[model samples]
Target chain A: MKRGWIIGGAAVIVAVFAWLLFGGLQKNVVFFLTPKELLAKGTDGVGVPVRLGGQVKPGSVKWNAQTLDLRFIVTDGAREVPVHSTGAPPQMFRDGMGVVVEGRFGTAGVFEATGLMVKHSNEYRPPKPGEEAHEKYKTLIQQSSQ
Target chain B: MKPEGQLNSSSDRLRDPSAARPPRTSIWLAFVSIGAVIVAQTYAILTSPAEGDMGHLQKIMYVHVPAAWMTFLSFFVVFAFSVRYLWQRRENDDLLAASAAEVGATFNGLTLMLGMIWGRPAWGVWWVWDARLTSTLVLFLIFVGYLALRAFTDDTQQKARWSAAVGAIGALNVPIVYMSVKWWRTLHQPPSSPATLDPRYTMGLRLNAIALLLVMIYFIRKRYEIARLERATEHMAEAAAMGGK
Candidate 1:
């Protein structure tokens, strides 16, 4: 009877722990927040170290080679956050690519990113025949290197 | 002089004629699996075209993904044998579970190292505290704890029972580690599958997984054999001491 009680108590404790890990502490477990979620936080989102993840807005990328300033807009369909970081992004970084940037949202309305990470999809396609794969990224690489 | 005498007797018992020798099949398996891994890796690198985005860096997937898969596979074996040990109260099952845990821990460490290598070039960071990465690290630590418990505990039956519970519980983290990306907002990409991966990369991934599976099997079998011999020697030493008393 004592053994059974001990076993029962362990099961309960494990169940509670699992629930807390997967359920009650979900917000803490999330590695990043979408722009829409961050925007929803309003003032609470500003000046706090957080990760903002979303697709890079097409045609919104502006890299200043002279100053090493990278500016891009992160969008999650509903909202967009303009991110300003000072570094060469990953080689895979491009317009419309999924990305997660770590930094604070300034009260001045730009995300002051301390870190920029490219998130690649699981797909791995080879360059099609008669098409050069490296050619497409050559300009971006050269620009970043300069 | 007394301790040295005890050690000599124990070594003699380790070479007892009654003890079973490691099977010839396990020896062949070790060589065959090692050969297969080399063949698979060479084939993968030589045949697969440069990826559209990451170029040749995509080749790292062949080793990294298979190592991670084998880590999960080994832990699953540990979980299975652990439960079996608890239910049947078999010493062999306990030994088998311990062997698998050691192999699993090895693959787990390899996976982390290879992932870091891939992450540095691909993710712009060598490590992250994301759900997937953190959970996998936790899984590795749990098994490390399981192995440590086995090493420190001298009471065979008690050690087996405690390890069985720990091993079973530790393995429960495997699925959580796998699903962490899907369940949480993480920097790590979702799990790669045939449907998600291009047709070109699938063959390489499959071959590498098979080769690694064979290697994992060979390792478990070899380790189990050594564990059995160790246990036999321990029993013999205990019997001799009791007889002397």
Candidate 2:
């Protein structure tokens, strides 16, 4: 009976630790913000690490191979913001794709990128005939109001 | 309880003559220490200074670092037990090593999962094949292989000797995994405690790590004791079968 108590007690302790470690500790606190949120934060260079999330604006990227400095523009459909970064581009870095750059706005009102992360959207795919995402959005809206 | 069961006596259980000694009190100490560790870790996470950079998300470091540290510590036990079993050919030591390997594998697996969870927000990717991450992955797989081998091998002697040999070889990777971040350019940062760590997080990390270490040792000891009991039960069953024949 004593041995059973010891084993049972140990098992319970193990289970509690497991629950705390795996269940509580393992769950991440995600604070994702859309481009509108970034705009609302006001683009003054505050020297704080805030993420600027948006798609790279079409035909707004310029690369300087000599210094490896790159300049681009990001857009949230409502506004456009210029960004600058200096680093080896990640393998997936490209144009017209979702990105989340970690840094603050520069003194010149440009979004300075200290670190870059490419966001892979699940909805992104090759354009199909009448399969536009906006069409799905419209269809859902029309069905919901009915 | 009095040691009444004759067939399950420690003396009869040992196949080798020199394989007879009382279990160490270190196992009990190891258990008490783990309880202390869990408490200390909780305290650190709650009261420790928030990092200037990461804020409250830094609290995850308390749990993450300790689990990773214990993974390494448990594997060191596996290595020691493996060497002892190989040298002395003791069934008890082999059992201890197997138990450690199983527990170490469990913790290592947890470390990776927790790491990925932390990494996703911090590094913005779920996983990358960096030095520290890849080597830890290898360590996890090796111990998992150790556990798999133990499950399949029924013959006690064969299992002991073979598993010991594999365990000894696999133990070589622990140090390599620890050093991989330094040796290679990796996205994963190097050791965060007692090394080049931020001053704010150092003491908190150390206290939490000590507590986590204690907890891990306790779990491994309990597992080893259960394994020994199972072995004893198996021995009794075999003896009963032999007597009926």
Where in model 2 is the C-alpha error above 4 Å?
Answer: A1-146, B1-35, B193-198
lDDT of 2 by residue, A1-146 (tens): 73365347546756764563357533321233345666666744345676676778878877665566878888888877788988654434556766767787765768788877665442212223454322222333343345
- What is each candidate's DockQ, to 2 decimals? 0.63, 0.03
What TM-score against the true fold does each predicted structure earn? Answer: 0.91, 0.59
Please report how far candidate 2 places residue B135 from its true position, in Å. Answer: 0.9
The alpha-carbon deviation from the true structure for residue A121 of candidate 2, after best TM-score superposition, in angstroms, is 28
How does model 1 score on DockQ?
0.63
Specify the highest-lDDT model's number.
1
Residue B138, candidate 2: how far off, in angstroms?
Answer: 1.0
Instruction: Please give, for residues A1-146, the per-residue lDDT of candidate 1 as tens digits.
Output: 73475478559758976895678867678888999999999999999999999999999999887788899999999999999999678877888888999999999999999999988787788888987664334576687677
True contacts kept of each: 0.71, 0.01
Question: Model 2 chain A, poorest ten-residue lDDT window?
Answer: A132-141
Clash-forming residue pairs, model 1? none
